[model samples]
Structure formats: C-alpha cells, structure tokens
Target: MKLPPIGSYISTSFIDWPGHVVAVIFTKGCNWRCPFCHNGPLALGVAEELDVGAILDDIERRAAFLDGVVVSGGEPTIHGSLPSLLRRIKGAGLAVKLDTNGSNPSAIGELLNEGLIDAVAMDIKGPWYKYERLTGKAVDVESVKRSVELLKSSSIDVEFRTTYVPHLMDEEDLRMVRRQVEPGRWVIQLVDTRLALDPALVGTASPERARVAEAFPDVPIRG
Candidate 1:
C-alpha cells in the first residue's frame, strides 16, 4: 500500500490527545494556506520527509504505553492514502485521532465509514465569511460545512476547534462559529501571534488567553 508523505513524527505526546498519550504524525502539504498556520514548513511541504514505516515500527514497539495515535497536518485528510496509514497504526493496537482543517468532507466521511478513525478534531477557521480571508485561498465553504455535518452526526468522538486569532477574528466571530455549528464538544484556542506562516503577523497583539477561555467555556478534550 502507498504511504502518504510523512513530514515529521513525535514518538509521544501527552497534549495531542489531552488525557491520553499518543504518537503524532505531521503530514506534509495542505490545500489551504492559512496565514496563521504554525507549521509553515510542513504546510508548504518543505519539511524533510521521514520514513513512515520506521516511525510506525517505533510506535508499535512503544504501543503498550500509548493510548492512541494522532494524525495531524498539514491537513491529514488531504492524503488519499491516509486510511491505509491509519490502518497500520490501528494494527499496532493504538486508537487513532485525526486533526484537520475541515476542508474535505468526502475524505472524513470515507475514513469514518471504513472505521479507520476513532476520533476527529477539526479546526473551525472562523465564521464562513472569514474562511477565504484567513486561508488565503479560494475556498468552497460548503465543503467545510459538509465536514461539520458529517462529524456532528458521527458515532465516534469529535471536537470542533477554533483558534481565537485577535488579528484575524473577534469574539463575535467565535460566537458565530458556535452558533453555526453548535458542537457539543468544542474548544477555543488562543493564537500565539509571535509565530505564524505570515511574517507580518509575528509579534502581533493577541487577546488575553484567560479572558478568551472564560468567554468560550471550553469543553475539555482531556478525560
């Protein structure tokens, strides 16, 4: 089976899955160029590709201590063979979580239908109007909405995440996202503007993290 372009691997992470420890696969490339993206190299596919097989072997060796594996991005769903990659990890006795930008509903639905993913964490860019602006790409907003609807009705676990980027979005924008999706499991993250894909945003002012959290009342991913 063909493997996706694996850019980087974290052998273990406690935060990626919140309550559980898991290995992380940061895939190379993305369909959208979200300026606030922190993984500039990976998103641009400039990060050196790693041996995916070896990393899977490592995770298999350490599987006893891990609760799951998180397939992150550069938009994990963008990879056509992502299900194959997840199957290998699942074979290693690790549950899998996928992080995505909600740009591809078809991929997400396919993975769920095939029982390849145990959970999905999709990022909500902002209100629909801000999508093209934040992503710096021509976007089909309906695709993103379809992703949300798929996750919303899925039997598996899901979390709709939105980063509170002060420069790119406001509290009202976040509220609009919540109103639009009404996800039961939702989280609001504060963007660290010090580092971003767009250099102009670096060192930009951000809202108070505590205040943002208070307003959003996060549904913890942690168990």
Candidate 2:
C-alpha cells in the first residue's frame, strides 16, 4: 500500500507546540485554495522525495528532547489513512498534533475519537458567506461547521486560528469568525508572503497589528 506523501519536515520548533520540541510533517494535498496559503506547493499536491523510515529515525533521535510530532497539511485529513499514520507515530511514544482547515469532519472525528491526536489546530478560513472567496473554491460550509462544532465540544486540546491578510482578513470577517466559535484559544496570525510558493503573493501587506487588535480586543493574535 502507498503511504501518505510527506511534503516537508521541520527538524525543530519552539512555537508549533506550546512548550514541546516538535518536528512538523507537512502532508501533500488540500481541498481549499486559500490565496494566502504559504504552502501552495503542498496545496497543489506536489510532493518531494519521502522517506518514512528516515523520518521515524529522525524522530527517534529527537525523541528524548522533543515532546511531540505535529502532522499538518495542505490538509492532513484528506488522506484516508491518517489515523493509521498517527498510530505509527504514537507508537514511538510521542504526542501528536493535527493542523487542519476544518473541511473533513469525519476524519478529524476519527482521529479525536480514537485518541490518535493530542491537540488540534483548526483554521477558520473566513465567515461562512466569504469562505468560497477566501478559499478560491466553493467550500462545503456545512462540513466546516460540523468540524468546528465537533472540535469545540471535544475534550482534546483545541485552538482556532486565522491567517491575517490585508484584503482577505477584514474587520467584519474577523468578528464573524470569533462569534461563530466559543471563547477559547483563538489565534490570528499575520500572513508572511515571503518564501511563499506563489511569487505574486510575495510583498503583499498583512493587516496591521493595531487593526487586528481593534477587531479582536481580548483574543490573542500573532504572526
């Protein structure tokens, strides 16, 4: 059987997880086409060479120092066999974190229900009405809703984040997203167009911090 494609890996991280040293695995493929997505290469299903055994070995080498492994994507849940992969990672005795776009509720539910993931960071692309505009595709709004609802009610550690872009992340859209989800760990990140796969996206301005703060007075927002 063909294993899921691995796009890229970060050998070490301080912020991917709160306090743990994490090696982030970027999986190939995504359903949405968010213009501000820096990992456009992965979003387009492009894959570099993958070595699962080498990855596992690297994880093993850092196992003593690292706290967990985060399997993010272009939409990791898009792969039907994600749970099995998570299980393999878990067998190495490291925690796992999943980053998703909230488009695949069923897969996320399985991961959470089966205790395959320790934390989940789901993205709220935009308000329901503007989801298509932000994603550059007609997204399944109901599916996104279901995923958000499931995560909000989940016992697992969960966080909701939005990549802050100038034209994409307007004040009204930000407020709408905040109200949709219950008060919890909400993060609004500034989009860094530099190093983005799409060259046209580079040099575009992100929303100013003051404007973002004005939109979200209490919620923590970062880049």
Give the top-scoring candidate (TM-score): 1
lDDT for model 1, on a 0 to 1 scale? 0.87
Candidate 1 residue-wise lDDT, 1-223, digit = tens = 8989999999989989879999999999999988888899999999999999899889999999999999998988888999889989899888999999988899998999989899888988999999998898999999999999999999999988877778888888988988877845788777777768999888888778667757766543221
1-223 per-residue lDDT for model 2 (tens digits): 4457888888889889888789999889998888788887889887684786688788887788888999988899889978777887888899999999999999988888899999999999878998987888888899999999999888989999987777656777777888888775788888887855546678887678887788688978787
Q: Highest lDDT, which number?
A: 1
| CA lDDT of each prediction against the hidden true structure | 0.87, 0.84
User: Which stretches in model 2 have alpha-carbon errors above 4 Å?
Assistant: 195-201
**Candidate 2's C-alpha lDDT?**
0.84
Report the C-alpha displacement of residue 155, candidate 1, in angstroms: 1.0
Clashing pairs in 2: none
Instruction: Give the TM-score of each candidate.
Output: 0.95, 0.93
